[model samples]
Target: MLTSLWQRLRADFAMLLAFLGFAALSFVFLKLASEVLEGETMTLDRWIITGLRSADPTVPIGPSWFETMMLDVTAMGGVWGLTLITLFVTGFLIVARKYATAGFVALSVIGGALLGTGLKALFDRPRPDLVPHLVEVSNASFPSGHAMNSAVVFLTLGALLASTHRSRRVRIYLISVAVGLTLAVGFSRVYLGVHWPSDVVAGWCIGAAWAILCWITARLLQRTHQIEQPGAVPVEEEGGPP
Candidate 1:
């Protein structure tokens, strides 16, 4: 009984820490976003954007290999790329008979996308014209869509999948990959000179916060038995088709 109580206490403490950390992160992101919207980050944005370009100002600074690599990284955050990942993951979950998990993943991505669109419209910030864009872009740029959606999709998917695994190392690896992909996508936006540095920062902040929020909500639902624990074996109905 004592050991069980101790484990419960540890689990509760860890969750409390997570909640607090996420709240702080969201606050910081919102603060940075507010400053960006107020135009306080313009000077810094210009410096970073210009620094990434060649002396000619129009050309990107990196060598061909690096640029080529970044293009691949950036594409992973793009619409079709994210769509494919989402569909594949969701489909796999459904095939495994984890319908609730699949539904939550789908909702999280779609909701995050809508949030990104609304925030872009709300801010209506323009793309960086400080340097030539390495790739074509046509949208408001306060918060990068690529960055936001990548975080939402990758992080949510990672966390959900990680819940199924028992190994601590495996869980860490999953979360790290999700975070790495998010950071890479955000950096690619700035490197391509289509987004200001602040834009990517804001995207990272908001996107991460949204993913955390979704995770917390799912946790609460599980506590209330609204949804089954993620990664648990699917329950077979006695009268249902196998």
Candidate 2:
């Protein structure tokens, strides 16, 4: 099984390349964030101090109802309540050793937390002082943890569920949910005035890279399991199935 998975990965060379590409992209984001977002927590911080006040938001979907609903979901619920709820749930699943699914979920939550915290510490950025902060926060805010965590958890969990099943409909549903939720979370950060547009963008990129790494780790661990098991020898590539 280990050999088979390795063969499979090599057979589709593009997949591995994608992983590297995302990591590189995330590194670039970090560099750019450090250079561009220096001591200028004015816009997002100001908005956070004041309150969410959209002059105009582009309509989502075709109908006004859909657009309105998305605004609320992404801006308020996702950034504040929903994001934390998902993190706790994912952590529980991981602690229970429901790997693959649990790893997928945990990667999103823990990875986001770590990445967000690391970035904050690296830059030592300051929070906004424009408004009265309802929630107590001590970290700097370049890449919003809420945005990053939400993106990873929803997207990777969706991918894991899709992969474990062999149904096309299930895959589509899972992927769609992931995309929608991630977008919602990102939008929420911007809408709720806690993050800048750039912060959200960086969060999305970092979250994606971290999630992919988790997937790769899970795959490698699975391979190790097969190798450690008794009598689970690898078969030679006898031109049977390349």
Candidate 3:
């Protein structure tokens, strides 16, 4: 009985933490949005953008190879790259017979992309023009799509994959990689002069909140057997084991 009670307590604590994280992120995004609209972040944005460049705004303050590497890192957060990743992970989950989890991941990524797009259109903010962009970009950039989508995809995948594991260290490692990738992508946007610092920050906030929301949903669904539990055995077909 004590063991069962401890499990319940842990679950409750996790849910509480998720809710708090979601709320905090949402508040930050909203606050940043208002400040951005008021032009309150323009000075800081310009300063950071210029700080990353040399006297020549076109030249990023880094080795040529480093700039090339940033381009590659930023590409990982692009639509095509993220889509391929989502498909690959989804395929793996389906092959493992975790059909519901696969569907959930697909929907979460798609939904996040749509959400980011809608916000960009709604804000209608212009891209940073203080420095020449190192990469091609054509979009309203209040919240960076690359940063947001990367967070949505990477963090969601990390959380779900971590749940499937039993080792605490493995779970921590997976989550750390996700966060690191998200941060790298966001920073790359600013370094490339394609997005303002505020834009990346806003993206991180909204993306993280959405990921947390999805995680909470997954937990609720798991409780009702609507989705496969972590480490659940594959269900056999009527005919028997394959």
Candidate 4:
């Protein structure tokens, strides 16, 4: 009884800390974004975007090979790519008899994408034109859609997969890959001259907050028996002769 109580207390404390951390991050990012939208951060935004370009405004700061690599990296965060990945994972979960988990994954990614779209429309910030864009883009850029969606999908997916495993190292590896992908995609946007640094920052903040909230909600549901724990071990029956 004592052990179980201690475990529950530890879990609750962890969740509380996560909530506070993400909340603080979201506040800071939104504050920065508000300043940017108010034109208070225009000079800083322009400086960072332009800094990624060569002396010749048309050329990107990096060599030809680097540009190609960034474009490839950016594509991983694109809508079609993320959608495909989500669908594939959802299908896999269904096949594995984890229906609730499948629904959660679908809801998390689709909801985050919709939220990103709504936020973009609300802010209606224009794409940076100070430097030539290596890739074509047409949307308001207050918060980077690619950056936000990638963070949401990757982090949420990472957390879900990590939960199924019992190994600490495996969990760390999954989360590190998710973080790495999110950062790479965000940086690729800046390097390709499609988004301001502040946009990516805002995206990361909002996405992380959203992912963490979803995780907390899922845990609550599991505790309340609203959903079966995806990582719960199945009980085996005693055989007649073994």
Question: Which candidate has the highest TM-score of all?
Answer: 3
Inter-residue clash pairs, candidate 1: none
- lDDT order, best first, reads 3, 4, 1, 2
- Report the number of clashing residue pairs per model: 0, 3, 0, 0
- How many backbone collisions does model 1 have? 0
Expressed as tens digits, the lDDT of each residue in 43-135 for candidate 1 is 999988888888888778868899988889899999999999999999988888878878888999999999999999999998988777888
Please report how far candidate 2 places residue 82 from its true position, in Å: 5.6
Q: In order, what lDDT does every prediction score?
A: 0.85, 0.59, 0.94, 0.85
lDDT of 3 by residue, 58-164 (tens): 99998999999999999999999899999999999999899999999999999999999999999999999898998999999989999999999999999887776
Stretches of model 1 off by over 4 angstroms after superposition: 235-242
| Strongest candidate by lDDT | 3
Question: What is the Å distance of residue 170 in model 2 from its true position?
Answer: 2.3
- Tens digits of per-residue lDDT for model 2, 68-182: 5655666433444655666665665555444445544554566666666787677665554443332345666767676676666666666554544556788789779877887
Task: Give the per-residue Cα lDDT of candidate 4 at 71.
Answer: 91
Please list the Cα RMSD from the true structure of every candidate, rounded to 1 decimal place: 2.2, 8.6, 1.4, 2.6
Query: What would the TM-scores of all predictions be?
Result: 0.92, 0.62, 0.97, 0.92
lDDT of 4 by residue, 129-191 (tens): 888888999999979999999999998888776665668899899889999999999999999
Clashing pairs in 4: none
lDDT of 1: 0.85
Better of 1 and 2 by TM-score: 1
